[model samples]
Target: MTVERVEFENTFAVLLEDILAELPTFNIPSEGAAWVKECLEYTVPGGKMNRGLSVVDTLRSLRGEHATITPDELHKARVLGWCVEWLQAFFLVADDIMDNSKTRRGMPCWYRREKVGNIAINDAFILESCIYRLLKKYFRQDDYYVDLLDLFHETTYQTELGQLIDLLTAPEDDIDLNRFSIEKHRWIVTYKTAFYSFYLPVALAMIMNGEKREAAFTQARNILIPLGVYFQVQDDYLDCFGDPEVIGKIGTDIEDNKCSWLIVQALDRASAEQRQVLHAHYGRRSAEDVEKIKQIYCDLDLSAVYHAYEEKSYAELCALIDQADANLVPAGVFTKFVAKVYKRNK
Candidate 1:
């Protein structure tokens, strides 16, 4: 890892310690608090922390190159970064149960742990509650505290709505291709993945910096929500085409009946016979059937199609960033995110 990445990891460890140290103040018994700490360690830190790290990145960019950020500022940045990650952990713990997922970050999901079955649901709630505790602890006196709280609540609701649409789109027992569309794909990606993943961290940074004007957030969201959609599209493409070793998870969108960009595009281009082929093999677990569906994708040239969409999306994002109101939020904030995500393989 680079020096900066190591620093992020080390700082993140400190943030966890700080959070753990505060747990006992909740008046819970020591045993219960210990389990919650273990749960937080297991769920919060494992993923590639791009969303969380982006908060710090934005803070630095906002502070500019010559200005030395103080220790207090760095601590606040890390707190917000981990807050985003903790919110994500809240969602994932419940989502794994909803999706019946077997593994996450190459280990059995928290929900799948022995003796942890239905209790993981409550644990997910606890994880979410901890966000407020942290915010209250660190930010209660800040002028933007209410804004931060409202932002998180609104983002959480948006994500839940997106998840609902996704579940309705591809319910386990119901495999209706008609439910899939480009519009629906956009909606699902925008709400479920984009809001929290793209907008929240940067928005948190902006609020942290006391940029309370609605126009700043409007400009950020305009660039960010679409960037988030494009990111999810890449994710959908990667789920099928990326190296499992590199991506760190086996692709199961095809098997799981996901409303993936590839599938939506395939449906758009497919003939009646091709559609029938999909109907036969779209959601099967058999290796042969999965291969058959993948064969259809290859024949449809979805890879080339994805490349074309990616290029167009990248150009559009560049234009938006180029046109961003640097006086308000700075173009560099959006540019930083685009640079990290665009054309990324994992």
Candidate 2:
């Protein structure tokens, strides 16, 4: 890792210590506190941390290169960044349960770990509650405290709604491609992944930097949401085409009956007979059936189609950034985000 990344990771350890130090105020017993600590260690800091680190990066971008960030200010930004990470952990814990996932970040899903099981449902809630707790502790006296709370709350609701759409559209027992579409895929990606993954971190940074203009937020959302959608589309593509060892988990989108981007694209381009083949094997858990679906995806040349879409989306994002108003928020904020995930493998 680079020196800066090492420093950022060191701060993560500090923040975790700070969070655990305060658990006694909640009157929890020692064992419960230790469990929470273990849970936080396992869930909060394990990912690539792009979402968490983006808050600090965005703040720096908004402030410009020459601006000075006080140590306290930098610490607060890191805390807010981890709050975003906490929110993600909360969602993923529950999502893994709902998706019946086996692994995450290459480790066994928390719910699948011995003794975690269904208690992970409540653990997810605890992960969410920690976001507010950290917010209140760190930002309660700031003018934007309410804004932070509202932003997190709204993002959570939007994500949950998106998850609902996904679950309703692609229930494991129900294998109906009729329910999948480009529009639905976009909706699911936008709400479930885009808002939290892309918009929330930058929005938090903007708010912290005191950019309260609604138009500024509107502009950021217009760019960042699409950017997020593109990132997720890449994720969908990678789940099928990228190496599981590289991406950190096995691709279960097909076997799990996910309304994935590849599936929708295949449906869009499938022949009548190919459609029959997909409908036959798309959601089956059997290895043979899964291979059948993969064969169909390969036959349909979804990989080339994905590459085409990737190029188009990247160009559109660049155009949007080029046209963004520099006065409201620096174009570089969006540019940095775009660069991070443009052709990401994980």
Candidate 3:
């Protein structure tokens, strides 16, 4: 890992450790406490944490008068980090169940743990509830406290709507090429992944920093929301085509029938024969069928097209951010926001 990546990892570890130390003080049974600790330790360690770091980095940038992140500031950053982790945990546990996934973060999915299984539905709920608990403990007295709570809820609702649309629009059993479209892909990513993943952390920081609560949220929605969608689209594009070691997990969107970027792009460009090949091989969990679909994607040469779109999407986001002007909303904050998540490999 590069020096900067290590910096982020260390910062994230500090935040998680503080959270754990305090979590035991809450009144809970031994099993509940053990499950919470296990879920946090296992699930939170796996991702790139661009979102969580964005919170800390943006806060640093927003400090107007030689600002310092004191212990209290560090605690607030850690709390926001906890929120990002909580949001991810909520989605991933449910997603594992929905996808029937076996592993996550190099460990078993929470839903599939030997003691958990189907009871994971409630486990997901508990994970989500922890976000509010952390928020209430850390930022409840701030004037923006209610706004922070509302922001998480609204963003979560948006993501769940996107997830529902994704599941309905692209059912696992049916891999119809017609269902995949750029428009649908945009919707799925914007609502399902970006708002919570990209915008929420920054918005949380902005709110805590005492920026115009309403205006900051509006600005975040306008810019970070689209940026977030762009981030997820790149992930979908990378899944089938990216290197396993570089991207970490092997691509399985086809087998999972995920409405991913490449499949939609292929559907948009496929010839008649290519269409048949997709119908036959798409979403096949079998290794051979997965390879066959990947071959067809290679035949179509989707990466070049995807790269062009990625560049254009990024350019568009930059233009919007430039036009929005950080003076109106702390430009440095969004600059770091984009930097943290511009194009992560894993």
Candidate 4:
């Protein structure tokens, strides 16, 4: 099991390198083109490439190793994997600006670079355009090409909707804790993180498999949407209570005035004094302020509530996924894959 897992992971790493290398060749090979290469490389590489791997792995699990996935089919899947990575880069570049985040994935964000700064927004647009170019270049001849294109468009729109709601609900100019809600948090994550991160890749795989447009969307939503939500909620849970060494980064959702599951849940159950404490200290970055907020959340017993939610969500998702026939797309594939993610603390 470990050997197979290692082989899968290693193959993914090489694929990432090739994707990065391939980006440079697309440029005109000029002076500033070098940094375009660098920007894309750094922004694209740092993400957990689980989304990309899920596409190929899901395809394999569905079609089986013995089935002949043509070299063209494999090429398109790899290219679609790059699209997922590009989508993440688009979000991260913009998100850093909104969160006032100085770093991402343990390095300086695109917006903070010497010649980049606010220009990262333009770079983000470039990253986004590459996705369509690649899709057209590789998958346009396939029967499912139009469906894949439409899925990417709709998925991007939904993510932008989630981001808009999130930004408006928690504006930097206004630090009001009253605006944050459990309902809003879930909605924000569902559209923003869940759709693109969870559903998009699997949807891409299904589209490539020549699944009907409606059916592909249906199957991806039945599992991937919930999987996306579960993934984001686990991220929120991990922020304050997680081991940074294991997660590979420190959590800062509180300090950033961002909407997170923990604060919203705590808000729903906080006493007047506890609410006041949170209202005063919620978005502060200082150790003293963060410590105070942590104390209040601890007093509220929100950790227990979060754990309850996690277990319940896991059970619900498991049931829904089980009801989905493996014959359509292999429920066992995502079930086995997402189970670890759903249960992980880091």
Candidate 5:
């Protein structure tokens, strides 16, 4: 895993080289170029990188032995993997600014950096622009190039729409139980998190391997979207119940007015008094209020609810993968994602 991670980091260097080479064509100012480099380095790398690396893993599972794969094939796989990471960086940079988040990946968010602030918004756009740049430079001549471009564009738009829903549903300083429905929560997770995080990687891998059938993409989406939603549900569970040290961040969903899965479930299960408790404490930043909402969750037995949901979701994903068209996508590609997330704490 360490060696693989090292290679992954090395690929970022290759991507940076590509960006630098392309910079001359744009006539960027010297200071602007340096800041762009810094922004890319700061926002793009780090983190667990599971989404990016999953592309390479899925491709390897589909294509057989690493030794048999040519260098060009391996390079394309890694490039696509990094493209997912770049896409994430783009979202996260803007998200931090919008969320007023202080930190990401255990450091100050790009928007919160000492020398950078609102400038990170433009940096986010630059991060997004790099995806097409990298794609055109590497895969422009390939048959699947346009498909890959469309997939990324569509996935990005879907994610932004999800973000719009999320922001609308849980606006800062504007907590309302009416907007925190289970249906809204699921829609937000499906578009915002699942499409880009889960489906895009597998879909990109499929395209890389020359599988262009619309049915194949649809099949991958059918299975992966729910898997991605389950993953977000787990994330919601962890935010309230998980150890901050273990999860690597403090849980603030309760105070952030998030349409969290737990909160949605709580609303479904809460009685009049319990619902009142939520109305008062759900989005406040006070530790006392956060704990009050958590106590309500405990009283409602949401932990048990999450466990049951996990088991059911895992089974459904497995069944879908089992029935997927083997010619279009290997079950292993989906199963690997399932195994990693089923009972994961971090």
Candidate 6:
């Protein structure tokens, strides 16, 4: 690991302690407190930490690489970064249940663990509430505290709205190719994944740095939204083509009736016979049905299509970053993000 990554991981223990230390104030029984601690530990820290780490990375880029960040500033950045992770954990717990997912981060979904079952739903809520609790404890006195609150709340709402759009667009009971389109796919990813995953961390860093101008945010959004859309499209592609062990989860987008990028692209280019095959087998639970859909994706050359989209997206993002107003936010802030995600495998 890089020195910066080591530093980032070391801080996680301190923050976890800070969070658990406050559980007593909630007047929970000892067992309850322990359970909450376990839930947080299990759900929050195991991922690649890209989204959480981006907050610190953005802060560094905003301040210049050689500039020294105060210890307090570093701690606050870590806290905000974890808040983003917490927000993600909140969404994933509920999402796993909704999607009936089997695994995450190479482990069984929290909701599927013994004794955790449906109760993971409530655990998801607790995960979300912790974001505000951390905000109130650590950032409450900062001048931009309310902006931080507004940012998290608005991002959460956008993600939930995106989830709603996705669920409605691809309801398992209904299989209609007409309902799947590139436009609808874009909307689902833009709201569901882009805001929280791409936009929120940098926005948090900008707010902490006291750069609250509307124009700066607008400029950031234009680039980050598309960056996020590209990330989710990669996710959809990986779900179909990626190695399950490497990705740490079984791909279910096809069988779950998800309105995935591949599906929409296939719908857009499919012949009538191919469309009929998809409509029959797209959401079925049978392995044979899934293979049929995979065969169709192969025949359609989706792998090549995705690669082409990946290239175009990288070029477009680079162009946007080059065109951005550096007086508002440094181009490196955006460039570093693109570098991290472009052509990523997991």
Best by TM-score: 6
The true-structure Cα RMSD of candidate 1 reads: 1.6
CA lDDT of every candidate: 0.89, 0.91, 0.78, 0.79, 0.89, 0.93
TM-score of each: 0.95, 0.98, 0.89, 0.89, 0.95, 0.98
lDDT of 4 by residue, 99-133 (tens): 87776777777788887888888888877876787
Write candidate 1's Cα lDDT for 225-337 as tens digits: 99999999999999899987787667888888889999999999998999999988897778998899999999999999999999999999999988888888888899989
State each candidate's clash count: 0, 0, 2, 0, 0, 0
Candidate 4: pairs in clash: none
* RMSD (Å) of each candidate, 1 decimal: 1.6, 1.0, 2.9, 3.0, 1.6, 0.9
Task: Choose 2 or 5, whichever is better by TM-score.
Answer: 2
Candidate 6 global lDDT:
0.93
lDDT comparison, 3 vs 5, better candidate = 5
User: lDDT by residue for model 3 over 1-346, one digit each (tens)?
Assistant: 8653465566556655655667668866778767767766666667766677777777777786497768678667756866787788889889888988776655667776777788788878877887787787678888888988898999899999999999998788766767778899989999998888878887888877877757767887898888887788778877777676776665668889888888888888888888888888888789999888888888888878877877897788778878885665777767776776566665
Clashing pairs in 2: none
* Candidate number with greatest lDDT: 6
For model 5, how does the per-residue alpha-carbon lDDT over 229-318 read when each residue is reduced to its tens digit?
999999999988987777766677888889999999999999999999999888888899999999999999999999999999988888
| Tens-digit lDDT track of model 2 for 1-346 | 8664566788778877777889888899998888888888898887898988899999999888999999888889989889999999999999999989888999999999899899899999999998887888899999999999999999999999999999999999877889999999999999999999999999999999998799999999999999999999999989888998898888899998999999999999999999999999998899999899899899999888988998999999999999989999899899889889977898
Clash pairs, model 3 backbone: 254-283, 326-331
Q: Model 6, which residues run further than 4 Å from truth?
A: none
- Which is superior by TM-score, 2 or 4? 2
Ten contiguous residues with the weakest lDDT in model 4 = 3-12
